[model samples]
Target: MSHRESDRRQFLKKSAATAAAVSVPYFLTGQNAAAADEQKANESNDRPIVGCIGTGSRWHAVGPNAMQLGDVAAVCDVDANHAAGAKKKVTEIQSKKGSDRQVDVYEDYQKILDRKDIEIVTIVTTDHWHSKIAIEAMKAGKDVYCEKPLTLTIDEGKKICQVAKETGRVFQVGTQQRSEMGLRFLQAVALVRNGRIGEVQNIAVAIGGAPACNSIPVVDVPSGLNWEKWLGQAPLVDYRWAKNGNTVNTRCHYEFRWWYEYSGGKLTDWGAHHVDIAQWAIGQSEDGMGPRSIEPIYAKHPVDFKDGMPVQDDRYNTATQFHIKATFGDGVVMDIKDSHQDELGFDNGIMFMGTEGRFLVNRGKIVGAPVDALKENPLPENAIAEIYGGSMPARGNAHMANFFEAVKTRKLPISDVFTHHRALTTCHLSNIAIRLNRSLKWDPQTEQILGDDQANAMQSRDARKGYEVTV
Candidate 1:
């Protein structure tokens, strides 16, 4: 074995041993354990104290949904305006619920982590900030509810998983498709698992392409915005703004996804959602199981590249169009691409095709020959119950409720971090293949790109000083 591989294996072994030493098993002996269990059950009825970080457009919905399950003790954002706005929204929601608790606002997230009273933290930060904050929060003894696309790079996923196992924290990824009210995703997974869809042959996931844009002009950093902290582990770049008509500086907020420095664009954005469900349905949503090979069949980016690195930093550099394919160990082929005119006839969603049946599923509907067959012979009750994590369909706030239940019981949630990391790794691999414009082989057990040094180097990136993410 190479020295690097040996070192990594040793580190992982040590981490697992440390985690085993710290983890408290579910069962304990004697009356003390019974008393402790009773105390925990009583505390579960009391509202959990929550703190929300990154109050952006998405958080407007996520923050309110979280409030339904917990008390909002604090709201935080790097931008002062966003923090204040979220604080006001929290107060309004609490008033409507007939609770008069006041919500605190902060420009720094560390203050929230420092508080002992906050039991849970909902992270809605940009793609680059997810793993760093999540690891720190777990170390601080706070359960985390992080948004999807859980890592900025493949190595970040491994770090987050290790820290979660070591701390035994209740870590939930925000892939709400798993708990959608109609259970469309769950039903599809159940059908395939129960042999309703013969042996799975192929899967297709259609996430739209990234946008192309000309170089944006650098502008003065806006007031009340800490640009340095916002750039956090990402490489430093001049602050740029969009010009409105003639002379208006619209500061960067939601547009960070288009840059390769900050995110993997649509590959990570929607891929985190749809590709995750595909992995779960195919029984690959676990540690040490992922795509064995990835190929970039076709691709186009907004800028030029040299050795897989984008040549320009000022333009929207992510792939604008692409068709990527991944092959698993069991010969299952997963084709991920932009909107394409194809036989599947789906513009957005997932499609599963097998010998006996085929089906298409999205947020709105699920249809196929297998579903039609289900009417004649309904799915077993146990199968349906297991898919919903032992709960029936149509439960209010099902995703958030599941996380809270896991927090109370110390059980893994439906979208736990380990499986989410495995799925996100597939997305990252697709992006890497596209950037390099070649086929690459992967070793899932070692978590490395095999026999290709250049591709292996893409597994991680160097963080700027003061923003390094270490387990």
Candidate 2:
């Protein structure tokens, strides 16, 4: 073995053996005796030594899938208490399997990366911190399983794609919709391409947008939590909960999704899933290609980012309503979302209304007019199109298992970053249009929004210092 590999082996041997003698929790001492042995054994047997970086409520739910996929060697979080909660679940798994794998815990994720034995790192941190740790973990030579909307800025997405390619590391973005089922639902899409849909006219999506945030009072950082690390790449503003002023206490945990500084809100949250389906439904995975033009007209209610800062308002800043018409080079019109009605509509899916017939697809179902058509004599086969699967992946429980499986095989998972970037590009444009409040034409080949300097600016975010996204 090379010197580096030899040192890694020695470190595992000593840490595991020595840690066993110390009866303290692994996070406190940075290693547990039994876990060190598990790490060494996993190495000899070729099983991946897995470590998770976030242990919030979401991780509590997603942990079992990863354990089923590989050996759970360690867990980390900014909060010690949260870490303990997650560590308990992992310990239970270890106990159930009767596998003596010790799960070391750490308040800081850097300690996990410092270990050369960890092969795959699952990052479920806040939206703002996703790219920061993901890029760093990949740099540390670990495969990354990052949650979606894997970037806080367009620049971050670009950097993540670049880093994955540069480091030769396998990276999977957790979009999850594309891998839910046995069938990909592409045959129907092939029919659409074969003109069975007959000259696609206008396509409409009805997903919602993120609300804007206003000024709120700063609160004390919780005890035993690494607030600075939590805010690693975000602005160094005082701590403010993502909830409204009166509800700030209710929003203390996991509600970080609604803040613009931390995330793009629904624009990225659900958009990552639905826009991905929309792109696949329309075959827009190829990054260099996108809508030729876009026009984001304000709905009756729109979030205004005046002076490039959020106004301190109690009402949410996310766009409750807005419309943007996307035009493709082939004269295909795709309406990403329609805000025509509020009571009930296709609010979270992609609908393609073609001349042949109107087809609609959502998470729960994919049904359309002439609904029985695919079942009928079906459209004649086309040499150009591959067979289309009938539906999106079932994300009820199997999402993370698929990710770990891909890691071991060194293959790109269904929700790989390359495909996600295109989908996110579309979703980001809607925000661009809404923020700029005007018509914008885009050059897909050029990857530029035409004519409006202000609209084009929203393509990237102002990353905080020490966390600027660079390729």
Candidate 3:
């Protein structure tokens, strides 16, 4: 049978087995935000104390949702001014919304994490810091809502999941698209499972991974900035652009995406979102299992390799136009890459070609592939419930909203890490292929690349000292 058919069968089987394991939610997690705010302030259900690790634009993206969920108790940023600015914004929003909640400001994120009163923490820090801080927070008993791509390396991926399992903490990797309403993810995932599209064929995803951000010259580190701490793990480099009074040459905090040391580039940045949706559609995001084979099909080299893997390419290392193809055991081909050809989802979207028809889905929209498929939306039953193993969310809303709801009612959010892991595996695996530039076979159940020692080495990243993420 085709991969689609096999997956559908597996889904049905799993559904039968897990029907009693997960309880369906009544009205979604935490009481409505309006209700949450109106909670009588009876010492028992006062506002939830909230803290943040990073306060950039992305953190602002969830400002309203976070407010809906809890009070924005504190904001932290390495740059003193950045933290102050965020605190001001939070205070304004709270006051305007009549939240009657106080917001605090802190220069060090560790201080926020140290709090005993903090119920949930959001880590919007650089990618390098995600696993370490998140794991530490979970250890500290504060549930996390870390920004994505959740982990900087595959090993960290395993570590975070392992830690989460050990701690029983409710963690949500920030991929807001997972929470979008109209043209949501589940419809497409369900269609794939229901065989609305027939025997699956090769799938295509177009997303531009990190292009070179630019080779900025090194300069003096700005005042009030802990350049050493910012570099954290990953080799320490001189600070060039500290974003003080005027812009520095090029080096800076957010732009860290350009360098491999800090992030996986857009390969993991946008990949966090696009790759996530792709995984959900392909039914791969679960546990630590990965694709059957990964071929680093495309790169600029002189890139060193250790253990048969490429050494970190410091010069804008992340793939610019990397194209990777992963073939599943049952002949399902998944293509992931950056694109501009059409109005695809987040630089890329998931395109599935099956025996019956084809379907494409991304954060922005979910479109039918065949000309008539869009017209013939007459599937008999709830196709979503069929293929998703009845595990994904039944309702779609802001991603954080889902998480907050899940936290209260104890239901799984639409983008739980298990499934997202599968998606990230695809994204991270594509990196493995581009870096190694070789066809590598994999044993999904075992989660290892076979035969090729070189490709296997890229499975995990070598984190810098003091930043090693341990399970």
Cα TM-score of candidate 1: 0.89
* Model 3 Cα lDDT, one tens digit per residue, 1-471: 766567656755554444344344433334353344334422356556788888766777655567665777888888776677788888888787676677778876778888888888888888888888888888888878888888777777777777878888888777766555453566766576566777677777776655453344566766777777776767777665433355332445667776666777667888788667656655556543357887665654334555444354334555667777787755677777666354434456767778887767665667766424646665545454433334344243346655665566555555566666667766676777676567777776777778877667766667678766766
Q: Compose the digit string of candidate 2's lDDT tens values, residues 1-471.
A: 764345334433543342233212111112242344335545667667788999887776567666655677889998888899888889998788667888899987889999988888888888778887888899999988888888776666777878887887877787766544423334444555555666567777777754444555566777877777677666665665445445552123465776566776676787787666666555555556567777775542334577444564333455555677777655667766533333235566667677677666666666665445768756565311222121122233335544554565565555677667767877777666666566678776566777877777777777677767555
User: Comparing candidate 1 with candidate 3, which one achieves the higher TM-score?
Assistant: 1
Task: Tell me how candidate 1 scores on lDDT.
Answer: 0.82
The order by descending lDDT is 1, 3, 2
Candidate 1 clashes: the total is 0
Q: What TM-score would each prediction reach against the true structure?
A: 0.89, 0.79, 0.85
Q: Could you tell me how far off, in angstroms, the CA of residue 241 lies in candidate 2 after the best superposition?
A: 4.3
* Per-structure clash totals for the candidates: 0, 21, 16
lDDT (C-alpha, whole model) for all candidates? 0.82, 0.65, 0.66
Q: Give the winner by lDDT: 1 or 2.
A: 1
Off by over 4 Å in 1: 1-45, 243-251
Model 3 lDDT, full chain set: 0.66
